[model samples]
Target: MNHALKTYQTWLNDSAVDEETKNELRGIADQPNEIEERFYKDLEFGTGGLRGVIGAGTNRMNRYSVARTTQGLADYLKKDGQDPAPSVVIAYDSRNQSPEFALEAALVCAGNGIKAYVFESLRPTPELSFFVRRLQASAGVVITASHNPPEYNGYKVYDGTGCQLVPELAEKVTARIREISSFGQVHKLEQTEAEQKKLLVWLGSNRDQEYIRAVASVSPRSEQMKSLAPQLKIIYTPLHGSGNRPVRDALDALGFTQVSVVSEQEHPDPGFSTVASPNPEEKDAFAMAIRMAEKEGADLIIGTDPDCDRMGAVVRGPDGKFEVLTGNQSGALMIHYLLSSLKETGALPDNGAVVKTIVTSEMGAAIADRYGVQTLNTLTGFKYIGELMTRFERDGSFRFLFGYEESYGYLAGNYARDKDAVLASALICEAAAYYKGQGKSLYDVLQELYRDYGYFKEALISRTFKGKDGVDKIHSIMEDWRSRPPHDVDGTRVVRALDYLEGIEGLRRENVMKFVLEDGSWFCLRPSGTEPKIKIYLAVRKTSNKEADQALKQISEAILTRID
Candidate 1:
């Protein structure tokens, strides 16, 4: 009759509970710490949807948690009424249990009399956004963890306008999720029953074609590509995720004849057999692609993440060695090539603008400004950039020419509200070809950019903290830093601080804090929303590459000391 055992008994007796779930719950009933961690609180729904480890606990991501979230969403939609229920689109990536989770969500929506369009198989996250807008669906859900590890999965919600729910709307969804007392109270219909009731609709190749056509139209250099396409030797890898077919189709349509796909990674693999992590932002993820590039003697190498929202590239340097470009360098090259080509062809818009996150390197801003284009900085997520694009399209302020984040996400057109690595793969190869025609390498352009913009180097350091205790430790670390802010770093005086959680400019109240030193070095600290880690970002501007590297090392050691 103890509290924990009683809760378990209630779950076992509930008609909605399955034998498998009951068995799993039985194993944790006697573990006090596990029970406390699982049932102490509910998973939070923030600006992004729910993301956590996949397990049988309430705090973890599971069918029950997904059902409750969908029911909450259904309730919210019911309140914002029309004669018929609102429509929703669901998509999944190649992750363990992703398809099951997507189907579970679709069933819940169908049970609530909502029209649900579920993809036949795994697809990229950005395509879900595009499908929502193209189908004019009221909302969308993508089951993915972006670049998180295999054990983790996530659910992201998007509005009718194809952007992630903003803060105010997310708060409402959170409130509704909180109102649900237990997972057994959430209702669901069998797939067959839902389909027979005309509530579930399966989408296949027709939608894929529509998305591909939209991606093709975003090409600003199609005509130039026709002339140089055959000569471009490019390599592409999806990293065993979802980008394989779409990226290949986009390139072949642009008349690129010599494009090669990394054979070992072309098929979707939930285990991501070829790399340690499927994230394109990490150099280790490109090991397979690099080997393939060397074998093919390719001029450039490109890889997309598991969800295909981010992209990374490697190019042959002037010294005949291949080097992976940082996110900032890749983004700068894309903007430089896209704008320069359009301006040359008299296609550049008079009010062109580029959007980037505040933590992203300023090299992009410098490049855009050189071309008479404005660069706007937003908060850390692509949703903010998408929101900005929607606003610009609503009011005639400026045309959204391009938008990117330093984590390898980039977008050139408004067809997709999220970053489309499939589109990026096509454009990146075209840019490489355009530069190759001028007898220059992408590396050459990057060096020139650094020479002109000063040697600006940036690095990201992430520290992982897991389990319930880790959360408290992370909080304590941040609180201690707030109490005794670093006045100096690496023998340099801190000149200014920007805290974003406070929403202030100089002394903002945000969870994020940025410190600028006397030598123009800067560092920032923030907790990651989608993962169990704290990230520190450092940037230093110096006159030479060696000096910048030295400054970066010093600053990194200083930050580590403070953390320790």
Candidate 2:
């Protein structure tokens, strides 16, 4: 029998398997293709941990897979020379079956003789990072899909320092996971028994208060926020995920009186009925918020992903129409406002630095350079950025002023090691209020920044490939790009090339390629660590906005047309 068929038979025959899963398998017994697709391979780890379409199979996310992965993580936590009395922090978002999956992981930890700190209710991903560090746990687990569609959910693992495990450590955990050949072998405990043994502890409201205060305190422009509360009308949407309460509480604590939550999307919605996908980076995600903003005469609109780790903003632009700001645009605006605020107060750190990803635009770096702050680039994922932040704390080399990626994720304070929409929301709104007091919209300020600095435009192109052959297809595309590097793009000479697979600076080797044009335009090709897609990133910097847009378009066409 083929390996896929053999695994399917074993799972079906295992007496420990749940009846629901057995029924699912039995229903598909006649469909050999379906069986192969479902059991072809185990779910692989990625930037967001074990993520897949929620279903019953080795390749999908189910209770058995979740429990099995947790058991492996548990073994890794209890390995020799590690913590003897290991405790794990667990939090879940507002996704279907998220609570159940979280409970299963907690039980698995408890069964392995490790304490489990499970949140009493759903919370944001960043808050989980905070509590993990605050409690000094052995590790952490957060159950979230993070802007993926409702059919998906995930499990992300974090180390004691609250940062997601880097590549080396993730490999260690993967090794342990490989030892568990069957889901039936996963360690588990009854919830009541774990609680009675003092192994299962629930985090509560007091911790929420602490996290809200931390997010509230991140804004240095609180005085400005208080002054312009009346002038700045804002609309926010949680996209029916986990950001509703904490984001609102943080705003209230910062003394913003003119904030309003999009009523249709303020509650927990695992299905995310309002939008096609919960990702804030997409323009459609802001449809409801935009309509509401128009009626309320709101000056700005903001939205966060399900787990609240990413944020997106919309403002009335210079054209007098409401336009969504790309992640690069948002990052540039926020950094400019933050550095200026700190400088005016004479609190700017001499050794402060900003961290971003390799695929991110150079606009923020230019703005930071104006204030004498340094910029560091990491691999694409936020975890790489988080790992760098942890290193900065350990060594006194530089103070982490801000960190962000071109995916609408940003961080301002050291309260958490992950991207935080709550903190970002507080600071972005404060920036709006501050500029409003100066009789300027955030868009107005953006135009002024463009005038001072150069105009920068960026775009991302993603091609998806799913199913068993998906991996091979993405690999083929990447290899084609690497072996046959472009000579020129849209009449611009390719002056330099960077193959990240060979290593860049002190960072680990990554599967990415970049070609820099003579006109200061550049494009990068990197595969998504968490999804079955290869991403193309294009950036252009020019003296005029028209030139920047034209160059970005021509470059995108020249490169992307070759993919097919």
Candidate 3:
């Protein structure tokens, strides 16, 4: 037998292998190609946790991998021991086998003699974070693949504070996961058996109530809601994910009387039957919501991803056509509305600050500066922003007012450590109401922002490379760019460069490289950590929107010529 097949067979025959697990292994062994794919290597556990296509291999997301990850987490929690019986909260999104995966994690936690609180139904990822703190659990796990396609699913680990596992803690968990040599060694207990031992518990509306109360407290215009709430018409779509219940409750609680949910995409469909992808950031995903909005003559439309950690909006433009706003544009509008409302009502704090990822538009910084609030830039991930929030709350530094990323993620009020699309949905509706009071549309607000911010525009280009050959191609692209960087793109001369992998700011050793041009046009090239893709981000600032777009297109072609 080949070494890889032998290793897998050994796992199948091991005494620790459960009947169901053995069945899965036998199925994989029946197909040679399946064995190659599943046992090629272990599923990577990085800062984000385990994410991959769901299948029967060791490389796929199954009960064994979930159990192994939970065991590692249990080991870490025990090592950082505060209590003999630490507790954890588990939540799942609307995905195929999500409930099964969530239960698998719960069972593993129970087998370790740790208390586990499993949600009664699919819930938003942010709510899992909120539940962690609300229950004061030692840790939390959310089963989701966020905006990925239907074939994919993932596991995201959250600490006691409800934030995704940070770098240091992730390393610890990775070490433990690596130590578990085979899937057969991982332990688990049946759900009923664990419940009888008092280790497994079911949680429900109590945590939901706490989250809703916290979200309600962050409203800047509760009194205005009473008067203007009846006049506004808003359309919302959960995109067949988990935000259906919480988003409606938040809108109703804020006194919005005429809110409608997109019926075609309302239910939890793992296939995301209504759209090609469940991501709110894409215009295609909003097609159903847009049709509903036009039918109902809605003023604004909002959509959340399957996991509800990211949100997007479409508003009526001056031409009477609905236009979907980009992530940066929506984030900037939210910041403007929130800060302006707070300042108008004497609620804006002197210590207020905002956080955004480095690649996010500088338009937000321009708005923050005008308000005399500090804006801090962090790494690409939202967890960095969450870490900054932790620091601010720990020390007497600037207060964390809002934090967001370019990938349609936003957070407000610090109720949840991760992005809360439900909060963004509510805030977008309130912002629409605020604009309606002034006889303007949210599109008008975006235009005004562009006028002040010099028509700042950004675009993202992602090239997917699949399998082993794809990895080598991605590395070659990065190396080629590093060796002979672009001195000029289109008609613009390169003014500066920033590399993140080498930890250099202007010119660093990192694998990421950014080229700044004389015309204020820029492009960044970086490899994705979770997937096999190379992403290029282009931004251009011009006096006119057409000029900025032309510049972006020119630079994009140049980048493609160099990389592709």
Candidate 4:
């Protein structure tokens, strides 16, 4: 029998597997393709943990997989021998089966004699990071797919530092997960029994209130906000996720009385019924908020992803139409606002530092330079940024002013060692209010920044590959790019190229290639760590927006041609 076929038969015969799971397997027995897809391999417990379509299979995110992954983590925690008793904080976003998965993880932890502190309901990913440190837990886990399609869900693990597990730690966890022979070996505790034993603790409003207070402290100019906020009409949509309460709570606590929530998307809906995707970066995700903004004549429209860790904004442009600001544009705006505001009030510290991913726009560094603030670049993930913050905290070398990634994730305070949408929401709205006080719009301020610091624009193209064959194709493309890099982009000479796989510029090794063009334009190609997508990041600097945009278009075409 085929390997997948044998695995399928075993599942059907295994008494430990649930009746519903066996029935689902039985229904797909005749379908060879379904069996192959589901049993080809276990849904990988990647560095971040498991993420896959939710269903009954080894290749999916079922209860068994969740329990198995938790058991692996528990074993690792015990072996590492954390001080005193080992405990973990657990949180979930408002995705289908998110709450259930969180509970399953908690019960599994309890079975291993590890205390589990779980949120009573859905919360943002960043707060999970905050609670990890606040509660002084040994580790943390959050159940969320983070703006992926409705069918997908994920589990992310964080260290006691409140940051995602770094490469070394993740590798150890992965090795432990592989040691678990079967789902049947993973133990679980009944919820009631766990609670009775005090192995399960529920986090409630006290945690929420503390988190909101921390978010409020991220604002650079609260005094100015107090005066201008009431006049600033803002439209915010949670996109059917966890942002509805905390995002609003932060704003309201900061005295932003004119904020309006998009009614259709204000509540948690697992299907994300109103939008095509829950991602804030997509324009379609802002449709309802845009309509609400137009009707209410709101000055700004902001949307957060399902996990509330990424934020996207729509501002009225010079053409009197609401335009979606790319992640680069929004990050640049926030950086400029935060730095300039602090400088004006003499609150800017000399040791302040700004951090961004290698793929993020150079405009942020330029803005930071104007303020004499240091800039640091990390590899692709926000965890790298968080790691830097922790280092700065330990040695008292540099104070982290802000950290951001081009994928709509931003963080301003050390309160949470992760990208925080609640904090970002507070700062963005406050920045809008500050600009409004000066009789200007956020878009207007962005244009001013462009004019002062040469028009810097960025574009990202993500090409997704599916299945085993597609994975092979993605690796082939990366290998080809690394082996033979292009000499130019749109006829501009390539001045330099960096292969991160070889550990260039004091950065860690990874499978990424970056090329810098003679005219100050550049592009980088890297495969997504969590998903099977190859992302191409293009950036250009010119004296005018039109020229910069045109340069990006030309360069994008040239690169895509070569890839194809």
Work out the TM-score per prediction: 0.95, 0.98, 0.95, 0.98
State the lDDT of candidate 4 residue by residue for 1-564, as single tens digits.
Answer: 988888888888877888989988889878998888888887764534568899987788888888878888898898974646899999999989999999999999999999999999999999999989999999999999888899999999998999998787887877788898667788789999999999999998776998888889878888877788888899999999999999999999888999999999999999999998999999999988888899989999999999999999999988788999998889999999999889999999999999998999999999999999999999988888999999999999999999999999999989888898888888888889888888999999999999999999898899999876677999999989888888777779999998998988788898889999999889999988778789899999999989988998999999999888
The parts of candidate 4 lying over 4 Å away from their true place are 1-3, 45-48
Q: Determine the C-alpha RMSD for candidate 3 after optimal superposition of all C-alphas.
A: 2.1
Better of 2 and 4 by TM-score: 2
lDDT values, one for every candidate: 0.84, 0.89, 0.85, 0.90
Compared with the true structure, what per-residue lDDT tens digits does model 1 show for residues 109-138? 998889899999999888999999988888
In candidate 1, where is summed lDDT lowest over 10 consecutive residues? 504-513
Instruction: Record all residue pairs in model 1 with backbone atoms less than 3 Å apart, i.e. clashing.
Output: 500-510, 501-509, 501-510, 501-511, 502-509, 502-510
lDDT of 2 by residue, 302-406 (tens): 999999999999999776678999999999999999999999989899999999998899999999999999999998878888888888898978899899999
Question: Which candidate achieves the best TM-score against the true structure?
Answer: 2
Off by over 4 Å in 1: 1-10, 46-48, 81-84, 505-509
Better of 1 and 4 by TM-score: 4
Candidate 3 per-residue C-alpha lDDT over 337-413 given as tens digits, one digit per residue, 9 for 90 to 100: 99998999999999999999778888888898899899998777777788889889889698889999888999989
